[model samples]
Each structure stands twice: as structure tokens, then as C-alpha cells.
Target: MSRQRPRVLARAPGQPQALPASLHPVLRRVYAARGLAPEQLALDAARLQAPTALKQIDTASALLADAIVAQTPIVISGDYDADGATGVAVAVCGLRALGAGAVHYVVPDRFRMGYGLSPALAELAARSGAQLLITVDAGISSLEGVAHAQRLGLKVIVTDHHLPGSVLPSAEAIVNPNQPGCGFASKHLAGVGVMFYLLLATRAQLRAQNWFATRSEPNLAELLDLVAIGTVADVVRLDHNNRILVAQGLARIRAGRARPGVQALLQVAGRSAERLSATDLGFVLGPRINAAGRLEDIRSGIDCLLAADLQSALPMAQELERYNRERRAIETDMRETAELMIEDSDAAGICLFDESWHEGVVGLVASRIKERLHRPTFAFARAQEAGVLKGSGRSIAGLHLRDALAAIDAQAPGLILRYGGHAMAAGLSLAEARYEQFAQSFAALCAQWLDEDALQLQVHTDGELRGEEFSLDTARALEQGGPWGQGFPEPLFEGRFEVQSLRVLKELHVKYRLRSADGQSIEAMHFNGIEQLRERGSLHATYRLAINRWQGSESLELQLLDVLD
Candidate 1:
């Protein structure tokens, strides 16, 4: 497919009147551009929004506390993703610490049971001989599953972050920040964050009842490491509250206080705990855990998280590493096929299906296609059921993917068998025979919803860094200034540079030694940009300042996002 050059636009600076004067000037400018206030910079755990603000949290906590007191066997129905796996670990560990007995979890096999809390999954959870079942990362839209579990004589607590359908599930308690009537300040909490908050509230409930008098009170803060991994892995918006969660977790991991599994995963990835960052959680650890769910089984991933020591977790981490490598190979093949499929298509919303594609890797393919074409995209693989295709979708800005699916379902009843997700991403299933109809309907919706400007890709930058600011210190400041992701973006600066020298690596990445207007030479890398460079001597570049460590030395490096004429 032909790639469109994104427009490089400078962000409008915000008033720094309320910001601290002691803040670094460039950092201040970046923060000001994001409209961040002084108080927002404090990412301490104390700054987290109270769980009481989440609708039905108290009720959910009460049910959990009662289950603990009654010694009720609790089964956690978790989705098969990084977020879901981490949430399951957090839920299991926290409950065990809080004195809950017989805690078990069931993760649906993606190839067999598909996504979310299906009736089959509910049946499996019930067989665990549990009287209470709580869903992590999913179940917000599982109306039939919720009813099935209840009918099987199990009380269900649905704790999810996805937007709900028109009719809410009749669970015993539902704890979602996005649920109707919820007044939580941050609606962007990942599924793991929601589960973490539920544990916090359940602890509080136990404390009020003096349930800890005979037992030690578990420090819920210890679970922040898992929370951080899941939140970043899920790609939720890093609002102030989420930033606090991520910052606190990163602090714990850096202090060498993270769980054995987390440390082991980092060890296998060759990352130092002392230098751990939110980006590592997303790019390094998250992908390994997710690989298990995508290719094999997520139970191994959860087991690693729940391992009591590194000795027991290292083997699992290595296994996950192998899964990740396999997943990458499959995803590369699928993405190449998808690119070829869309090379001649002009659909505003692109949908591509291949019977040979791996179901778990379709989401990754869709995400790549969406980035390449700057359009809403969906990739599908044949499901285990004949004539059924499981698809995953990634959306561009100004498009709510789940709502668009809802609109399509409303316009044509029974077209989408199931669907649920946030604005940017979602998953669903439909008959293979109806694929063309669905694709046409989705493209028409995208055409109607997105304007020409919205369809155009735009790279928003924080303008340029001054000559004196292009130093390792400035890069470190930018690095520490954020657990940045999603809504809260990391800083990118745009400027023109003279190419002192250029070399292509692996026949794809372009490495450059560029001289700024001030005659200062800097090293930069543009991954997958060999074609875009085209022997250019000078170019406008949008890049991020980074500290690149090599051998035993550290130097300033520019991570180029775009090169323009």
C-alpha cells in the first residue's frame, strides 16, 4: 500500500502560570502544550482518585469481603490478554493476601472459547466449584454469560473497563468507571487498574470490620507493579490517575521490589530493573505476556506473574519469550499479506481476511494496517466454527470503533454476533458469507463520520529544541517527565537538519549523523525509513530526544518519527 506523508504540526503552547518555576524550561513547554497543571506533575500514589467514586464499588467490595469471610470458593474469569492476565494475577494475589481461600481463575482459550466471558467460559468457571465469579478485563457486554453464571448458582461481579452495551448485565455487582452513573474522575483506568481499585476498596471494607485484627493487613501497594504492566499493556489513556498508577509501579520495579515474575521477565529481556520505565512495560514485558495468549495459552503467562520466586518464574518467562518470537514471525507474514491485499484498495475503512491468518495475530495486523493507511482497519481469521470469522479492529482518531460496530449491527440485525471494546480498538465475530456486506457498511460509515482532514494523518510536535537544549540532561529530563502514553503523549520536537552522513541498517532502518543549525552533530535513527530518505541531504525531521546507552556509555539520540521535504 502507498504510504501518505503525515502533516507535521506544532502544538499550541499552554499558559504556564500555574506551573512550578523550578521546572525545566523545555519540560515545562512540553507540559504546557499538554495543558498539564502543576498538581498533575505529582504522580505519587496519594494523588490517585478514590475508588469510592467508581459506581457500585462499595457493593462490589462488600460482596468480595463477604465471600472472604464466608470462605467461599472464588473463581476469577479473566480474558486472554496482557491486561487480563495481569489483572488475574493482581486479583488472585491480593485476595490471597487479604485472607481469601480457594482462589482459582479460568482464562478462555482464544481459539476454542473466543474472547470475553462466553457461556462456555461461564460453564467452565462454574465447574471450579466456586460460588462467586468475578470477571477481569471483560464481561461488560457478556449479557448471556452473566445470566448463565447466575443461573448456575454463582454470584458474578463484573469488573471491566470497556464501554457497556445498551442493556447492562444483571451481575451481582458491576464496577466499571465507564458504566452509566459512574462519577469517577478518570474513566481511562485499564482493566487491571479497575481490579486494583476493587482490591483497595475490599481491603478498606475488611479494615472497617476489624477483619485484620487476627491477621496481618496486606499492603495493596505491592500490586502496583502488576497494575502498571497491565495499564500500559492495555494502551489505555494515561490520565493523571493512570500516570500515578504507572509512576508508582515503575518506582516499585526500579527499587527491586517488583514481583518475581516481573523481574524474571525483565531479566529475560535484558532490561535493568534500576532503569525500568513505563515504555519497557509496554514494549518489553507486555508483549511477552501477550504472546502467550496470542499464540498459545495465557495461563502460563499468569502462572509466571503468580510465581512466588524468580527460580520458578524464569523458565516460564523464557517460554513466553519463545512464544513472542513465534508470534512476531506469524504477525510479520500476516502483515505482509495484508499490505499486499490493500495495495490497490481505496476503502475508507479497510477489512482484510485470510483463512490462513492466526486469530490472535489479527489485531496486530489491523493495527499495522491502520498506521500504514491512516484509516480504520479490521483483520479477520477463520474461527474454529465453520463459516465464522473472528476479527479485530483498530481505529483512527475521531472514530469510535465499538460505536461504529453498534451502528452496523443496528442497521443490520444479527450481522455482528458479538462486539465490545473502547473507542480505539475492539473485537467481534461474524459469518464469512457476510464479510463483503460488513466491509462495505463499515467503509460507508467511515466515509460519513470522518472528514478529509480527519482522514489525513497529522504528526503533532512540540516545535523545536534550542541548540543548548540538545543534551543528555535534556533527554533524561524528558524521559523522567512522563509515564506518557495514549492521551498524554511524550514530547516530540521538529527541526531541519543537515545530513552529515547516513547509513542503512538491515536494509530498512536509516541511521544518520545530522548537524543542527548551531553546527552541533547529533546521532539519529529512523526505523523503516530507508525508502523515505531517498538520499536526501537535508530534511525536516520530527523526533524525540532519547538517551541511548551503548557499551558502558550514554549519549543523546534522536528517534525520528517523520522526515519531510
Candidate 2:
């Protein structure tokens, strides 16, 4: 964690518009560090609202309408992750609300179906007698899969956010913002967001034609809770449109009107939906949604999102909580094992493989090890029956994981076998015997692609804060600004504090009630910092800040990130 902290970025890119003319020092520091200018914080309802004309959405609108008119049998294909599962639920519900009762959905099992739309999935749909296949959160690169679906007499409409390949799929309609030949601003839209907008457009077209005479349109905005969950869970950028969606969903959640599934899930995780924050979504909710893909089928994930009754959702939520627990245990065990492997192996890059490691948890182990070791790391688990190993890799910034694989794909003839993903995260399969070759080639490519600065990790703080500014109102404003996920990060402010006192929290963490050098007091805490402080045998430190909650009340807490003497 020794990366250079940029000296307070004067203009963090893409700051919100129309900020106050004279901001508080803390606000200026926080906003400026996050790439904001005073003019950028223009919090106008008009500026923040989503745009209507998203190009060719009208075509998607017309296509779905025709499908409804002809009563075409349709199936929604989704990934096993939260974004994909919620996307499937959204498409089905939104479509059914518009009178498409012939709709069904399909999700791929991670072990068998793998990721994305493929020939096997097409074959599955063909056998199901589905005529129109709409893939959500996937299918952008299914060039072969699209062709296979067409041959099987299926019309495919893909709403995905994956980076498209050079040869675009031959689908009847493709609605990915990142795909070529199509222009949709906010390239950072998540898969669920794309699906959500497509549904909105479909509804608009139906209303224009007076499709609903007696029946009123279901509150489509009600689905924003799911949309917001998926958007944040998928780790996509929260642009203007997405921020509004997230903000609206958060407001509803705080007001106790989020969906039954979300509400039930909060109860299972011992979190109150009324107190939902982006921190909860990223750390708690996202992991639960991902647990199904990590440990088992994502049916529980989809069920948790689509459950109609709060009571009906409870058992699924309980099971998901169980999965998340098991997931954490397995990830911890595997990461420890992988770290030992790295400590021994003198390799250019890290690639640890084991037949005993749970396959579902390897990606997470890879990510954890990457954070610990600060190198591009890939954790591999053998599919013993296939005589091959599947690996999920994570990398530091500056190195594109997918492009690195593409480079290896070009240089080495048949080494990688199969692969695809984005810059920071990726997946692939290769022969077990070729681990050395693959490891060497990938390491060489990473070193060539990555600079020294990319390997170091640094925390970016919004600004420093004083105890006086830490209040219920300030925290509330920050909380409202929250539900902050990727792109729009939760504000993190650092401040110097004299350690007035400290306690060993279960011997696993440190608890503190601090006072500034000027006699200002602030409640503070440092999770997992007991050992570090004990090693030094002192608590004279300064730390970063976050709000600590208790008994329906909020106060500023200095979360001791690193102990600086």
C-alpha cells in the first residue's frame, strides 16, 4: 500500500455539476480529491435526469411489441451474478406487465453452462421451444452463439455491457452501450441498467400506441431498487442517469419501501434496509448475490431478487446468508493456501493451482492474493475430469487483463484454450500441464504492460476533516449522497488525531475514542489494527474517517486505516 498519493487532485474527472459557490473546506477537499469543480456540482433535477432518446431503443420497443402481438415464445438468458439475475427478473416482470405472458427465463450454471451465451445455451433454448431469446448482462461477444441461435430458428435480442469483439454477433437487435455501430452515452452503464432502459423504452412505445386502455402501467420506477442493487453490485460507474436511479432507490429503501426481496435480504444479513448504504451494498449485498455463482447455482440469487412475498423470500435470504458465510470461509482458506504457494514459488508472476481448492471460490482468492501481494495474480482450480484448469485473475491498474490474454493468444498458439474479460478482472481455461507456460507468458506480458506505479496500492481520500464538522446533518447529507458505489465513491476524509484512549476489540480489532491535538473530540475505530498497534505498542496515530452508527443515531468515527506516527 505504498503507492504515491496524488497531491489532492485539483480536478477529479467528471465531477457533479453546479456545486455551491463557497464550499466548506472539508467539502472542497473531498469534492476536489474526487475530481469535482465548484461549477460541476449543479444539482439540478433536469441535469441529473436520464435522457430519453438512447438510439435504437425505439427498435427494441417495436421488436418487443411485435413479439407480444404475435405471442412469440420468449426466454430471457441471464448470467448467474446479481446483475444478470436481477436483469432477468426485470425483463420478465417488465415484459409481463406489458402483456408478454409467454415469457420464461434461463440462467447458466457456472460449472456447466459457464459464462455468457454459447452454443450449448442455444441448444438448451431450442429444446425448450422458445422462439425469441433476449440475453441480459451477457451475449455481447457470442458471435458463434448468435449464429447457432439463428440456425435454431431463434431471434436474439442482446442487452449487454460487455466489451464487444471485432466481429459483432448477428442478433436481430443488440443493445449494449459498448458495442460498435451503436451510440449510447454513459458507456459505464451496467448490464442491469441497459436492461432497465430497454424496458422503459418498450413501455413508452406501448403507451404511445394506447396499448393500455384500462390497465395502468405498473410503477416501473419501483424496480429501481433492483436496478440500483445490480448497478452497484456489478461495480459499474454511477453516471448521472445511474446516480438518479440509485438515489431514488436509496430514498425508497430508507423510507422502508424497497422491494420485498431486498427487504428480506437485509433482515437475513442482519442489516436494516432503512439504514442501507452503498457500503452495505458493496460489502454485504453484492457478496450475497455473488455467493450463488461462487458456491452454487444462482437460482437463489434470482429468487432472492424476484420473491413476491417478504415471508417467501426469508428462506432464500437465509440460504443466501449461509452461502455467503461458506463463501467467506472458503475464500479465506484458499487465499491462505495460495499465499503460502506464492511465498515458496520463485515465479515471474503468481499462479497457484490445486485440485482440492473449491472452483467457485478461486476468483475471490485471486483477488485477495492480488491485494496482498500487489502483483497480477491468477488462482487456478483443476477441473480434474476435464484434465484442465480454469483460472480467474485480477490485476493492478494500467494492465488490461483481457488484452494480456489476447497478447498471449496471439503469441502462443494453443496455450490459453479459451478466455474473455475486462481490464481488471478476467477468466480463462488452459491445460493443467501448461500452467508453467501460461504463467510465464502471462507474467512476461504483465511486466511489459504494467509500470511500477501500477503495482503499488494507495488509498484516495476525498479530504481531511475536523471533529466539529462531524454531525448528524453532515453525515445525513453524505449518506444521502451515498448508496455510493463505483465511479461515485463514498467520501473518505482523513484527519490527525491524538489517541486519547484505545481498547482491544475482541483482540481482532481496535476501538478508540480520540481527541484532536487542539482538544477536539471524535469517536473513532480501527478494525484489525490491534495487532499492528500492539507490535509498535502504541496508539499515537492519525486516521481516515467514516460515520459510525449506533442505536438509530450517527456520529463521525475515525476509522484508523493506517497508523502514522
Candidate 3:
């Protein structure tokens, strides 16, 4: 959907280092170009910064240990996203394994109770007889929710990664690297990662108190598989510390040590856990879990993760598969309609709304339009409350969506009733009657802030590749190099290629044979972009090296990212 032409600039290799003689030359160059030092390449768990360095993590761990010792009832409140669901599952599973008593969880339905540990969710936890409330992936901005929980006689601990507001919430223990005065080096920990650290700290505390004298200590590392899945799903930048976590988790999954739910979801998606990669985790399994949260109750997804075996998790996985199918259909329809709106607009930013759109899928729709136009885009659906619309926004690289909204709110008070999110994504609520005003304001703000060059879509590539570097072994080696995602990107290579053959698939995908100057032939695909390519002479193409499997065999292929004729 992107309109970017291949810029094809050879990335500048950062501070130089001598790569290992045995390492693939192309990989060594690629890693160096991406600013990786020789030492950062090895993703050892020991390289991870200590959890105790995170502000208030020690206090939060002690609180949990005390709750376990007193046998107090604890409720894990979670968000409805993949990060939240996996964090809740990790917390409950790890805490129970650590001998915590009466552990339970509650995930707010996106449409009903909204996001975070709201007062309504707190009352539900209270009714369930919870003595302590622990929020995962949320509650950093829940000033009112934390106060309500405190009033309801619940000891609270907040663990989150979202950017915090000027005023912090009043909680017994708050552990977020992004929070002011905290020195946790890696600020990119996913919600599940935060919960995982908390468990590690709790285990250490219990060990110091000799609480594990009669019982064997729970192996917290076993939870890394879930951590890996959630971290990739949340789309956080994978820094070195996160790379270690994902690498360890992926190792467990590849070694057939994945949880039954993970196996089941992978089965439904037709992906093999034995050969799992971070890409598979992000695309195949993450969406299935996220589908439950998008279209139905997130509890179903958590149930699948919490199931004991593949046989038991199968039903939920199948149901999630069904939800994914339904979600795809809805997304397809919403994307089509949103694209129509984009084609008709000339605004620097895009904001669209239709009463018929499902509130649950606006974020996905927003993402699609943003990719299509490379503009900061927001898509809205009618809220359950009359005269209100809920919107989800996605931003391009140059623009910060949340900061823009915050500025607009400050300039025009009451324009945004509620809003919060990161730089790339955000959400807001406002009066239905004020849609046009808000759109105009947002578009003007974007125009005022963004330069013409910033709005231009550009794709950076790692320059040309040699014939020997295009082999299946090279692809596999590149895949094994590191767990790549948002910030630490997978390599994208660009070169001139002869269009040996071309055909359209499903009227949407372009399937082609590309011949290198050295006569190396490779199959390539450009999904959802058949209309973008015009048959011509040798063309410049940007693509990622990838492995394709069919009929129990694997082959090297190029995943086309963009093309220039």
C-alpha cells in the first residue's frame, strides 16, 4: 500500500569493527550498516540489564511476595491488546508457579468497560474478593482508576510501558522505564516483558527470604516463549536487551518447548513451531491472539494461552481462527471504504468516520489508510454512547500523533475528551458533532508541523547483493542473525533485476521471476500491489531475503517491499 519508490541508498556502516571471519560477509556488512557493534551481535541473556535497576521494581516485587506469604487474593488486570493478554497470562502462570495463592485475572472488554484498570473493573475485582490489584501493560495514566482501587481497599501495583502524563498515578508501586526518574536502560520492554521482570524480582525476593526452602524455585525463564510472542506482537522497538529476550524465547519455541496454546495457534496458522522465526510470531500467531481481543472477549485468547495441552487449547485456537477470519473480512471492507475517502481528500493528514464502521476495527483501518497514503490518519466509528465517536490514529515517521493531539487539545480545550498513545499510534474520543472541526484542526496542525520532504514516502535499502549472498543458506543465516523488528530492522536489499516473467495472483498480488545480472533466478512476490508495477525493462526493486515453504520443502525468495521502473 505504500507509495514509496526505492531510494536505494547504501547504508553507512557505523563505527567500524572486524566481524568474525566465519560470519557471512553480507551479514557482517548488513549488521555493521545497521549500527550493530561486534559485541552486540551475541544475544546472551546475561547481557540484559538487571530488573532491579528499574525504578520501584524491587518494591513491587516485595509487595507481591508479601501478598503470596499472606495468601491474599490477587487479581491481574490487563489491557485488551496482545501485550496485555500475554502479560496477564505470564503473570498468572508465573506467580502461581512461584506459589502465589488465589491468583486470578480480569481483562476489560474493549467495547464495554473500555481500556485499563477502570473503576468498573476494580469493582468487579472487588466482587471477586481480590485483596491486591496488579495492572499489566496499563494503569500508568490511570489516575482516577488507581484512586478508585485505593478507595475500594485494594493495594495496587502498576506495570506499564506507554508514555506517562505530567502527573503520575497514586499507586503503592509503579514500575515503568519510561516514567520520569527511572533508569531502566531499555525503555522498549513490552507489557509482558515488564511482567516477566517482576516475576524474576519476586522469585529473587522469595529466595532471599528462604521461601523456597521446602519447595523448588520456579524457573522464570520458561515463560520466555510467551514473552517473545507478546513482545513481537506489541510492535515495540527491539533493542539489544529486547533482542536477548526475543532470542531466548524464540530458542525455546524452536526447540519444541513452546506452550500448548502457542503450538495450537501456530497449528491453526499452518506455521511450524520447530522452525519458528520472529516474523512468524508477529504475522501468524500474534494476529490470531489479537483477533479475539478485536472481535470478541480477550478472555478467550488468555484461556488459550492458559490451557494445559494442545488438545485442550485446540477449541479456543479454532475459535480464535474463526474470529480472525471474521476480523479479516471486516478489515477488508473497512479498508476499501477508507481508501475511497483517502483518494478524495487533499488534507496533509486524514481523518475519516462512518457510522456503520465497527468500533473494534477502526485501529486496523487507520493503519491501512496510513500505509496507503503515508499520512497521519485517523479512522472513527460510532461509540456506544450517543453523540460520541471513538477514533484510532496511526502516524508516519516524521509526525508524532500523540504529541500533535496533545498540542491541539492544549490550543483548543475540550476538542479531545480522552486520548493517549505512543508516537506512531494514538486514540481519542470526541463529540460526533465536532468531527469536521477536529479534522480541520488536526490537518492544519500536521501541515504546520510537517515539511514537504517529511511527507514524501522514502524506502531505505542496503544496496545490491552478490549472487552468492542470495542463497537459501544466506537467507537462513540472515534470519538467524538476530530477532529483528520495529527499530532493529530486518535487512532490505535493493538492486536492478530483469523481469524474466510476471503474472498476477488473486487479482491483487504480483508474482514474478527476477534474474540478477549474474543470472541468478529467484521467485518474488508483491502482495496487494499489482496495480503499482508497469511492465518495463530492468527495474530497481527493494526486497527482504526470505524463505518460502511448500510441500514440505523450503526455497529462497524475495519479499518485495517496493519497485521503481
Query: Which candidate tops TM-score?
Result: 1
Alpha carbon lDDT at 170, candidate 1 = 96
lDDT of 3 at 353: 95
How many backbone clashes does every candidate have? Answer: 0, 11, 0
Candidate 3 deviant stretches above 4 angstroms: 1-8
Per-model TM against the reference:
0.98, 0.92, 0.97
Sort the predicted structures by TM-score, highest score first. 1, 3, 2
Number of residue pairs clashing in candidate 2, backbone atoms closer than 3 angstroms, sequence gap of 3 or more or interchain: 11
Deviation from truth (RMSD, Å), model 1 = 1.2
Return whichever of 2 and 3 wins on lDDT: 3
Worst 10 residues of 2 by lDDT: 1-10
1 against 2, candidate with superior lDDT: 1
Model 3 TM-score is 0.97
Cα displacement (Å) at residue 156, model 1: 1.3
lDDT of 1 by residue, 6-79 (tens): 99888999987668888888988899999998879898888889999999999999999999988999999998
